[model samples]
Target: MDRIQEIVDFWFLPESDENYGKQREVWFKKNPDFDAEVRGKFLEDFEKAEAGELLHWSESARGSLALILLFDQFTRNMFRDSPRAFAADGKAREIARHMLSCGFYDELNTVEKQFAALPFEHSEDMDDQKLSVKLFEELGSGEALDYAQRHLEIIERFGRFPHRNEQLGRESTKEEEAFLKTPNSSF
Candidate 1:
């Protein structure tokens, strides 16, 4: 029910009036396979953000934002994929950066509760850790794997991964998997 989750939900839910699918068809052509609880939480967040309730962006947002921008740039240079999906808007990025600098994530959890109280159109896409890992890999820093593992462990520990994905899958490039299997490769 966080603000970011809300934004993510509003942008993807087929039934949502604010669905971003029409504007970004390729990003969301097929419906995501998320459960009702997850979808509800995301919608909860989206409603709060839309209501003008300020969210404290994560401390990791600057790093996250930078990586996404870099990945877009790298892909443009290397493979010429879709014209950069990262926001080029300096104002928005700056606002996000400032939020990251000013607030703690724990504080944001309270804000998320307020968001969850509101009703909103349902949405279903909550593979947040998977997306994080993908973003990390695209940045080519290998930190994505670390970030993914942290989230995956939480899901496993909480027994949520099975409900989320029968596979409870985590992305791994062939090279990365090989590296993990190799002995004494910790860096």
Candidate 2:
């Protein structure tokens, strides 16, 4: 398979296999450098898109940029062993920084906008959650309200995502899992 398809598969593999999440821990433990290798590949893809070399999988620059950011964030969370993984202190700021430079937020539709705000609200900043809530409210959709409520809850408490324990390779507590199930979790 082509490289892009491989990344795409990597992005969704866990959804396809219930064992995939646990299995990934095994693979990465054997090759701790793999995460950096994957990040390099993502940077290459982003650069290629900048040079107008992207093909087949997507046609829009915005979609491509969002996908890169999404997977970048996801991989960092999933593969905590990655040397380049985002740290807790400034993770949200890093994502928001990327989003600012993305230069294509306005091009997204309402639904896409909601999904695109993941990096912001899911950040370490409580204000990012407010921004996310406002953005979702602007969409005026029921799904958005659900998201707004969830973001509010996070902002009210941790000011960051807690259900991330599983992906961060820590066992999630019962309270954490209960919190995850109660609202709109990333899972």
Write out the backbone clash pairs for model 1. Answer: 6-46
Lowest lDDT sum, 10 consecutive residues, model 2, at 19-28
Whole-model lDDT values for every prediction: 0.32, 0.53
For 1-187, candidate 1 gives per-residue lDDT tens digits of 5444444343334334554333343321222342233344343433342343533332454333322222222222222222221122222334333433555212333222112111110011135344434434443444434635555444434423222221224454455455456553321
Number of the predicted model whose TM-score against the real structure is largest = 2
Q: Compute each candidate's TM-score over C-alphas.
A: 0.22, 0.47
Off by over 4 Å in 2: 1-64, 67-103, 166-187
Give me the displacement of residue 158 in model 1, in angstroms. 41
lDDT of 1: 0.32
Stretches of model 1 off by over 4 angstroms after superposition: 1-31, 54-95, 103-187
Q: Report the C-alpha lDDT of model 2 over 98-124, residue by residue, as the tens digit.
A: 544665456655544554565655555
The number of the candidate with the highest lDDT is: 2
